[model samples]
Target: MNGPALSIQTLDKVYANGLKALDQVTLEVRRGEIFALLGPNGAGKTTLIGAVCGIVQPSGGRIEVFGHDNIREYRKARSHIGLVPQELTTGMFETVWNTVSFSRGLFGKPANPLYIEQLLKNLALWEKKDTQLRMLSGGMKRRVLIAKALSHEPDLLFLDEPTAGVDVELRKSMWAQVRRLREMGVTVILTTHYIEEAEEMADRIGVINKGRLIVTEDKKTLMHKLGRKELLLDLYKPLEALPPSLAGLGLRIAEGGMRLVFTYDPAQENNGVVSLLDRLREEGVKCKDFNTRESSLEDIFVQLVGDS
Candidate 1:
């Protein structure tokens, strides 16, 4: 509701090959909130993150991190944000402790071994701290990346595909750590392919497609705005086709006429379900059972991208 911790105003990016990567994208990430950017591959998510983190330069527009312009005040703005890249590009021979420590030093921060210790411990990387990067498992390496990102104590952190290719247990642990980070007052902006992760962790959701930001709103608001639930009626007997009298009701027959699926907006003032059932009885249609199912974020994402 207030001024966001990070702001992207009319952001645009174009590659040398004349491909547009971002198109006047405008977004705001609130302080102390977990914001998830959801999109398909090549949706410019990584490019947007790279622009804000000073990795890939934007062709146009402004990025402000907590009142500091990312371009003009590069050092100060960068010091306030940390990025955990999708790739695990840690130094193969460097110990986890050394690598995390080195990342902190890169930010021109004074040595704070205690902070590094706590970060590693919090990420469940303390036991692996002494192990070389190449010697650790893929999951451990991912945690080390997170620890390194938090090494400098940034106010904002970017996690790009943090749970990609990880096991269920590791993913759960990572989600728990993300919640802890938000509780610790770190504003987290993550780009993820896993809609479940966004649905589970994010306070707000932003959808991007074809280098354009389609929507950004509260997670619940987005879900409510686009989510749909269907009432399915299992017919006791199979019918050759839907009766002509029920044709105007917008119901589709399924399972070779043994089932009928009716899609209706639950938010509407009147669902008209009872009337439809009454009409069905008039048509001699009897249902053995009925149930409802809700749509998920994945459904919303596909619809949004398709429309965009």
Candidate 2:
């Protein structure tokens, strides 16, 4: 618990078809921190998770879970890791309690009904413990997956799209639970497309593109390094052309000619937005109203992946 919960060193994966799924990927998850992995489709997010969980074999490199090498010490490493996959594939005829308890036994842990009961209660699944998996709703089934993952009290938990297709209320509740898990000193690593989820829960963010890690930094640092602020100008009237004096200002027309957008960094010496507006006035250009838009995680993802 005092050291890194998970570590990857030059991890690489290549399929039999000669396609590279991961390229020299290296990262670490600190104890008690939420680490978010962000990427577009086919960016190797699932592949990376698979390798660490002992599902998919890596063509090269090493992964360690709490000081145990994933390949050499498969059982010891895997015993410390719990992965809740994106898909719901529980046995339909199995009762919730049976399935969760069985998962703990798979890791060679003795049956501890108390621990399983507590996990079910924490996930709000205790009431449905006797019900069969098929009788549970989609959201409830997802919660069962979470309970199974936590049955053994793993030191590191991987949540792959944990909130996908879940209702707003349930998603909020799940995030609160995850925060509590972090407070208990468990490392949480999640892969998600929901930018707001990462923005809200993650202590650090790692962006992957084309099977390679673009960068990994503290959430605030990543935002400050790549995020841009935009000023949106709602034009009172559409103009066919721009005036000569406003030529130096970088302004883009958007929303089918109904708006003009300008992008700038607020931390720079001069944003030039005030000067741009002054120049627009000097050139007889008018606008009805204006608003500012801050760059979101999605915006940064788009920019980074697009550049790569």
State which candidate has the highest lDDT.
1
Task: List the global CA lDDT of all models.
Answer: 0.90, 0.87
Pairs that collide in candidate 2 are none
What lDDT tens digits, residue by residue, belong to model 1 across residues 1-43? Answer: 3568999999999988999999999999999999999888899
Off-target runs (Cα >4 Å) in candidate 2 are 231-263, 266-296
Name the weakest run of 10 consecutive residues (lDDT summed) in model 2: 239-248
User: What would the TM-scores of all predictions be?
Assistant: 0.83, 0.81
lDDT, residue 195, model 1: 83
Q: Candidate 2, overall lDDT?
A: 0.87
